[model samples]
Target: MLNEEKSTEAVSFDTEMSVEKAKDAKKTLKRLIKLLFNQKQKIIIVLFFAVVSLVFTMTAPLIFSKAINVIYEGIKNVSLSGVFNIKFDVIKELSLLLIAIYLLSSLSNFIQQHVMAAVAQTLVLNIRKDISEKLSRIPLKYYDTHKKGEILSKISNDLEKVSDTLQSGMMQFITAVLTIIGSVILMFSINWILTLIAFLTIILGVAATSIIGKKSIKYFTNRQESLGRFNGQIEEYFTGQMIIKTFNMEEEATKTVETSNSKLYSDEKKAQFITFAINPLIRLMNQIGYVLVAALGAIFVIQGRLSIGLIQAFFQYVDQASEPLTEAAYILNSLQAAIASLERVFEILDEEEETPDAANYKTISNPKGNISFEDVKFGYGKELILTGIDLEVKAGQKVAIVGPTGAGKTTLINLLMRFYELNGGKIKIDGIDITKLKRGHLRSLFGMVLQDSWLFDGSIKDNISYSREASTTSEAHQAAKLASADYFIRTLPHGYDTVINDENSSISQGQKQLLCIARAILANPCILILDEATSSVDTRTELEIQNAMDNLMRGRTSFIIAHRLSTIKNADKILVMDKGNIVEQGSHDELLAKNGLYSDIYNSQFARSITAKAL
Candidate 1:
């Protein structure tokens, strides 16, 4: 249960960090959008279309009103000549003008929308590429603390929201504002009294939307976060499906998913309710404004203060004015969602990158691999794993490191590879500080084989030649034979052409180890580190592997970490470590003579193995 608490705590901490990083992503998106507008001619063209469309839409009502007034004047037998002079024939001409205006307005709208989408999509594509490149350059520690699902969600889900905002939201926002301003001006020109009534209703509608929008912001943010957690859980379940089934924890896993699903459903329903409420509330206010405008316009016509044509124009203008207000409300909702996604993506982009300051450093070309650690101190966080550790290995010498569990043997190798920096003292290779060499060049100098061998999904030939430098198929085959892997590989159905899925391959642990060794041998590094390389093999296989190890270690500086004492009996030097300190060091025979920690460990481990075999 304590372990469960620790795991939950770890999950919570990571989630919070990711959420904070997402918030920073918004700034990155905003900067990208700003850069798009740097092209002044393109921006001007889009704005010009928007303005023209709004102007043409506002003129439609006046044209219809004039046509009605012309008919009324002819029916009343009033002096239609020079009395508010608008020719009956001219009214027909004006109707045609109104049709032309609406047609132009529709064309302009289509062009502007297309331009906006093109600009937005281009910006989003650039952002996606930048994020992918940045993620590749980051250190492995970042991945250790992050989930694959959450990272995938940012690229797929969050990035899609940003795209939506660009393609539609931004252009709609601008168009809505322009539509409202143009319609309002025309409304006032028709009837000041009616315009006030329409304006008051719009203000009330906006106030309502603003209040509800604020509450919806919190819900939207929660919804996005819940989705990220849900994705992470799904990824974990699928990756560990075999373990869960073996343990018969299917019900427990289902419950975990249900809990997350329930939270997401509730949050989504709440957010949808609020967002849906916006359109209806605005429509209701527009209906009220419509009634008020018609009532006020009727009173003005009866009082002889306004023409019937003018009253008709006021009614039409009121409806047009309401459109922009409702559209503004919709834009606000979309902006909220876009902002939520942007914040998440920015979090990853903002993380501090691994130090890349090995620029003033020199390369270790053909490094002789004389390694020395002088008073080295290291730790993970606060727990010191290695203290005052001092050791040396000459070129072409094989040194073995043996220790009880938790004695920092692996940590020492990690320092040598520069996976983690030392907290104190210095390490040197061939009389040069390892820290003073480029990280890539320093790492290229060593070949490593660990107990757990990882193979990417590829052909056997491809896996053997994973290094950047090119090697022929013949060379790969030669290396595989040296590692004793060629015997089984040649017997496989496809031999070198067989494609291996990342999962569902049936290679034994020993075979996998040999493959890893073959991969390392193909690199031909001057230094070699073998960490429990033969721990997984059977007696017969171990003998074959030992011979391969001997060939690989020839004329190369080697560091062998092993628990099997017999394997290191022929080593030039054996260092016995315990509790972050080297308790004893000498040739294997000399250590046996001392009969201290090294001898006791060897006697106990090897004696038990021999006795078990006798039984």
Candidate 2:
């Protein structure tokens, strides 16, 4: 009972979100139709064949009625004889015509189906291409705000749904509508009273279906959202499985996933419950309509006003008319899922992209490694993280920034890369404001190797030479050698050609970081930034990497963010940051001489090491 109440509350909340999604669905559907319209020529041909098929199908009943009438005339004209026989010449001819029409209809159906399928596949291809382009253009903030699974759901799941709907549902809808309209008109030609009765039943069935559909569609939309959240959880949890196990959080993670799964299950059940009932309810209405048409036809025949053959034909028309109505209703109900999917996909497409650069942006031919920050202020939102910050770096200098976590060490790197726009002040390179230069051009002048090593699924050589497409194999080897990565890479079975799959679990984290260093080294940028580049490796590997980094940083202005005081002992200048401001700035020995914040931090780490050794 408690579960039931929780489900109700969840459903109610989901209903509101679903309603908003549904409102957008219509607009999204229109846009989808517009996309299909791009291949209007193929669609037009498909429509023509569909209509021709419907005409043959609709005319078959009239021909069948004619055959019945022909049989009646033949019986009436029969002469009394001991071996009396009746000729069915006219009936035979009509039967032959009906068979031919059915054969032609099948052929037309096949052609239309083939064309429509081709059109659907092409549309999906184009949409995927557009989505791929959209991903590259969307701002970094968009990625920060949205979960990876949600974006992927839009691309893969949502787009696939839209494609399925277009392939099958769209054509069914058009044909069903045409069948209904044509059946109604033909039924009227035979008997208006019976036609009216049939139409009333159709309207009642549609009304009931509409009521059910309205209730069900909300749940369907809710299910989509739940599924998205569930997928995101899976993606997050799977990627963080190591951390979860390390912390013994397996049970907690399972409970969290179960909660998400339960919500999805509830919504799916409610939605399916309502939607699945529509068909049976409509069938009930159709049965009632059949009874009325049959009973009424008998009375008309007995009154000598309606012929038996005509009544038979009218009965067939009633069946025909009601079927399309039922079909259209069901197709429309099913389209809700597709529409919900479309809404999500369109939401991504409609996200604001990164702003384009100024028409006449600055370009650097040969950037000197001179960087300065003048009164720079920044924050995630309202509270400034770095207020009234200033800094200056000369070419080919090694500058190390040491600070406690959340002291704006990484934020400075983010600002320098223009990953986020600053709230106040300016950062300049070679006396020119970085903001005046195009983002691509500005970023091209600097190279970064952060703590998190990003290596895509590719060969070792490919990963090493990612920054420079034109870099030769020799250049990649040289870069790897400089980063102390060449020997291990060469030891692999495929050497540089060994494929690094998505997980890259084949390579150690230290190796991955070394490859990243090699990549940055290959870029040959005027300025270099290393954010805890050696934090993940062992002492021995760190020494090797530190040596490689020293070589890489030569002839370039370098900024290093480090917590290990030993690593930065040789730094030309060490900036001791506290609470987002540089509290002290000088050479390492000078900072140690001050006996202030830097000394305290250095002593604390030394004490921790000695304490660990004693333990």
RMSD of each: 4.8, 5.6
User: Which ranges in model 2 have alpha carbons more than 4 Å from their true place?
Assistant: 1-23, 82-87
The lDDT for every candidate, in the order shown, is: 0.80, 0.83
TM-score of 2: 0.92
Worst lDDT 10-window in candidate 2:
1-10
Can you write out model 2's per-residue Cα lDDT over 438-545, one digit (the tens) per residue? 988998998888888888988999998999999999999999998899999989999999999547778999899889899999999999888888988899988998
Report the number of the highest-TM-score candidate: 2
- Weakest ten-residue segment in model 1 by summed lDDT: 1-10
TM-score, candidate 1, is 0.85
Query: In model 1, which regions exceed 4 Å deviation?
Result: 1-45, 67-103, 304-313, 402-406, 506-514, 533-542, 561-571, 586-604, 607-615
* RMSD in angstroms between candidate 2 and the native structure over all alpha carbons: 5.6
Tens digits of lDDT, candidate 1, 1-615: 001011122223365333233233346446656767765566688899999898888778788888888877766665546455447677779878988998999999999988888777877787788788888666545675677888888888888987998689888888888877888888787767788899999889889978887667667777787788889889999989999999999999999999989988987887788778899999999998898778877878889988888788877777777877788787777777777777777767777675674768977766898999999997655556677988888999999989887677877887888776788989999988888987788889988888767778898889888853499999999999998999988888999767664463577777778788888889999999888888878889889889988988989989899989888888888889887789999998899999999989988988899899999
